[model samples]
Target: MSQQSNDEQGGQHRRAILQVAGAAAATGLLGANAASGQTARPGGRDDAPLGARLQGVQHFGVTVQNMDRAFAFYTEVLGGTEVMRDGDFKGAPVHYTLMADQEIVARERRVDPRTIGVPDLKGGAQRLDVRFVQFENVVIELLQYRDAAQPTGSGDSWAEPRDHMSPAYPRSMHICFYVRDDVNFDTFIADLEAECARRGMTQVRANRTVAVHSEQERRAAPRETNTIKIHEGPSNGWSIVYCKGPEGEQLEFVQVLGPVKKTFADAAEARRAATNRG
Candidate 1:
């Protein structure tokens, strides 16, 4: 075939790929299950309204400037068990394209940086060092990005000792750990405060326990327990405290005194039966 013919065929192929990507990108995750011949089975975890097919909170990640320092803080101070570490995480093709939008990989591959779900990936991260630390039922991921582009779009790029938004800053996030039911709340706070003080942690504040549940909520619990973890703590409620972790990462601890109030599963079951009978 002639060079012109080859070029024309390549253009057609590329156009086709872009068209399919644009269409399927809207329902990409759900389509993955269908693509594998998995449909909504009765009583299955995913059996729900199309847009509401969510199971639960899987995990959350935060980017840190120093991996080892953050690792020690989470593991030693918080008693989190380090489960896994990925020195180099092989992200999707879209990840590289978004990170370096002006690079050859993005330009040559015809990857649109404005793909629906991916808003904008700031800072061209050189290397991704990740560690998974599990605490009770949840896992927290610690990410250390080497030589990241400045969010301000100034001063080339910075490595360790980089800047971050404080806890009060918009979009700044924090992870709150629940104090064990068996442990004394005051003792937990004392140990944590001492550790943070030793490490020179900033912005440490432990607020007095408050009853967050309103009178309306207390009255509704007999009927509403099925949908959520309604009655979590004692009638007096829980206490919350905040501190700055390594690199000023916002940290939170919550303690609910006494055995947590049970969600009336029997009430929910009776409600379901009534609905069926009706």
Candidate 2:
């Protein structure tokens, strides 16, 4: 083919991609509605109706500055197991493109520095060094954007290390991890506090045990046996503490005491039933 023909074909392909992206973007609001358990349309005809597809929290992600430091804190301090690590994601085209948004926008827009943080929306991110660590039942993904034209603030992109937010804040989201009631919450907190002190990590809240739940938990229990365990002690209910990760990302550790003993054959089924009841 001639050079002119090749350029024209490329332009057509780019335009087609943008068209599809625009359509998906238009449906963003409906998707949010569905996620919030609302049927945007009546009689279940809504294509984006809320579905009980989610079984449980699979993972939560945080963007960090140093992969190694984050790994140490999560693995050594929090008792997480390293699942996988990708120092460079160049070989994975689909994953890299999804992260970088090279295909979402035309080549010209990619050079714009304003296009940062978002890959599927309007901006792109540099190829990242990603690490996945399993913290008990949930996985935590730590990401570091490499060579991206983005701000390297000490804290969040806004450079605020508040580590918390008001309930009214639209961007308020925090990852909470669970600790076993059988395990001593005080000992766990003491060890983690010592680790943070030694490593110079910001300890948002010190080791403190509070009666976070009492009658409410007992009332919620399905059986008398489960109720007997509720609020018996610091280990029988819940104890919580807050700490910052390598890049000042806020995390919470929760100790659930007297947890129910019901077992479900299918977690998804239980989740769906819970959703319906809610």
Would you give me the overall lDDT of model 1? 0.53
Residue-wise lDDT of candidate 1 within 1-278, one digit each (tens)?
67865565455445444533443332232354656878767775456554345423445677666566677778987888876664432233334433554554556767764432222323224434557777775677776645443322112213434366457668878888887668666566656656866876433333333432664443233321211122453433455566556656677776654343222345557756754453
Best-fitting candidate, scored by lDDT? 1
Model 2: CA > 4 A from native? 1-55, 87-125, 148-168, 203-236, 259-278
TM-score of candidate 1 on Cα atoms, chains taken together: 0.52
TM per candidate comes to 0.52, 0.51
- Count clashing residue pairs per candidate: 0, 1
Which digits, one per residue and each the tens of the lDDT, describe model 2 over residues 1-278?
57865565455446545543443333332245545767546644343335543334556888776666677788887778877664333222334335455444545565642344333221124344566777656677786655444433222231223445443467856678777758765566556655776887653334223333554442233322221124543344545666455566666767654432222225557777777774
